[model samples]
Target: MAQLSDDCFAFGGPLMSIDDAVGIITAKVSAVTETETLPLIAADGRILAGDIAAPLPLPPFTNSAVDGYAVRASDLPAEGEATFVVTGRVPAGSAAATPVPAAHAVRIFTGAPMPGGADTVFMQEDVRVDEDGRVVLPAGLKPGANVRPAGEDMANGVVALRAGQRMRPQHVAVAAAFGLTSLAVRRRIRVAVFSTGDELASPGASRAPAQLYDSNRFMLMAMLKRLGCGVSDLGIFSDERAPLAASLREVASQHDLLLTTGGVSTGEEDHVKAAVESVGSLVLWRMAIKPGRPVAMGIISGTPFIGLPGNPVASFVTFVHVVRPTVLALAGALPEALTPKPVRAAFSYKKKAGRREYVRVSLRSAADGSFEAVKFPREGAGLLSSLIETDGLAELGEDITKVEPGQSVGFLSYAELI
Candidate 1:
């Protein structure tokens, strides 16, 4: 793991913009140097450690894209249908025994390699066979039609995948097409996740009168897993300054990141800020965002640590904006910025200027035939139901203070946040 300087994330502003926060993490943090090779089957979600060059051209051979009659373009009549002798047949796995000659058509099935001297094809449905046993090809059937030239999809030796790319199923398919069984990928980032607060108790545990189940820890771990992180669930640490500080130091050596869900704010009960500072260093990030303004970015024993807000919604939102990019940087992956699609707002909203806000919204079909965003009825960061019932979020920029029905808004689906 790469260690950042103490001042790398240091900012003078009272409230940092989300973009500025992301930029600092991306620009200052260095990726871990370790990598591993895994079979392409298990490589999905892993980052590419190096470029993948195509071993051979896609398709590898010139073939027919459909069941057709292959013919030489020189033999076709320009203004009318032409009759030709059917000389040979080519199935997907079989080849023409001899080169197709001029003035002759060869029966070719989909995926069959095109025979030599044949530069065009006429779909079997578009031609007819007369009683004389000669096949007729239609006029204006352009030359080279229906023929899939070798390397048409991608040429040999081309860079098929680049370094720092997260492998999707489509990328795996491409690698398989190139006859590759495995790929070199960066190892999953090791992260230690926990929650902080004396009032919190682990789920399924006997709860005290003032205690609530620790939901943020489990939520953060799940989110980290989606990012291909090797997560160690450290459970909860009570709001004790000394004990919390000791635990943070103990785990810092084993993980690339230490993430806590609470105790980052300036409240007296918040020990995460002081704990981190005692162990190593801390930078309180008063981010200019809704539901997650009090974020903490720090370093403990050279490992990066981030403390998100305690509320469930705040934790979820801050994790998406803060911990996400930090993890990507550590894994050597390219920055995956979330881009919201434009949708019509069906509800009115008001927010302060200079602070970004994400409104939970479900999309519905509108009379105009386009998708419109409908806001959730209730509000509060603690309501987990809001996240479950919503399809995505409507992003209100820092400059915007209000919204009206039919206004254009940027919406981000939950599917792409990771």
Candidate 2:
């Protein structure tokens, strides 16, 4: 864990640029060491702790790609078709007792191993079968046609999956193909999430004079869950310092990461910043990005603490941009794991020069067969409906003073992050 300076909350200097803020967080956070072996059924979405090598070839032997007659290419009749005696039938999971002989064909089904000395197969549609079940080779049948060679899919001792790769359903199939019952993966990081503010009220609670239902916690939890983290909800914390401090101390010892929304800004009712400063260290606050400028990062009792903005849209953006990547890295994921490549902007909007901005935009296809991005009507950070209606966030650089209607800007697909 990294400690924050006493002046970490002082947000006066030219609003920290988005790039600089990412670099700071990347440099400060340390990766966790916990790991475990999980069964194949439970390994989906988990990060691989080691490379998965193939113990043997994927197919393990030459087999038929389709249900057809297997024959030697040289044994075919010169002009039309060559007739051969059907030696035997080989189905999937069965072995051929004897090697195939010249001028002989074998009846094989899909996925069945190709008998030795047979190098090609003719589909049943291409050949005619007599009442006695004997088959005739078709004309123009090429050598090695429709025959799957040994080790074509995967060679023996080949590395199918590299270390640090996140496991998906396809990866699981690869493991099963290699006869692996389980895989070594990093354990899910335990995260404790909460919101702090007197004005915040849990949903279904009686509305206070100036209180609003706290939605940031739900958003945070969803984002954490998508990152494969085990989340512990701490609920909402009042403005009092004692309860907040107790909750922080208790969760710090039990969880690998602690996250909270609200109380990170400069408002007097913001007690999360103060509590973190008193108990732990506040590393950085107030990023240069719009809609999510009031972000906080710190460490408490060797556990990482992320204080997201109180606004719903701001909280969602900051979590995807910052907290998600941090959590992934702490869970032993590679540095390049969370950062997605920028898509070419479909539409453009206006912005000032010094600050970075992320605009919610819906993607549309144009008459010219190209994608055109359209911005949401509302730009306020508190407008949650804008995110729901939009496709993804369009990232504007700090140097971008004005954007033309069709100019290309950096865009991030929402599906890429969530």
Model 1 residue 302 CA deviation in Å: 1.0
Give the Å error, residue 250, model 1.
1.1
Worst 10 residues of 2 by lDDT: 1-10
In lDDT terms, which candidate is top?
Answer: 1
* Candidate 1, residue 259: lDDT: 88
The number of clashing residue pairs in each candidate reads 0, 1
RMSD (CA, Å), candidate 2 to true, equals 3.2
lDDT of 2 by residue, 26-64 (tens): 665656666899999899888889887789997888889
Question: Model 2: how far is 51 from its true place, Å?
Answer: 2.5
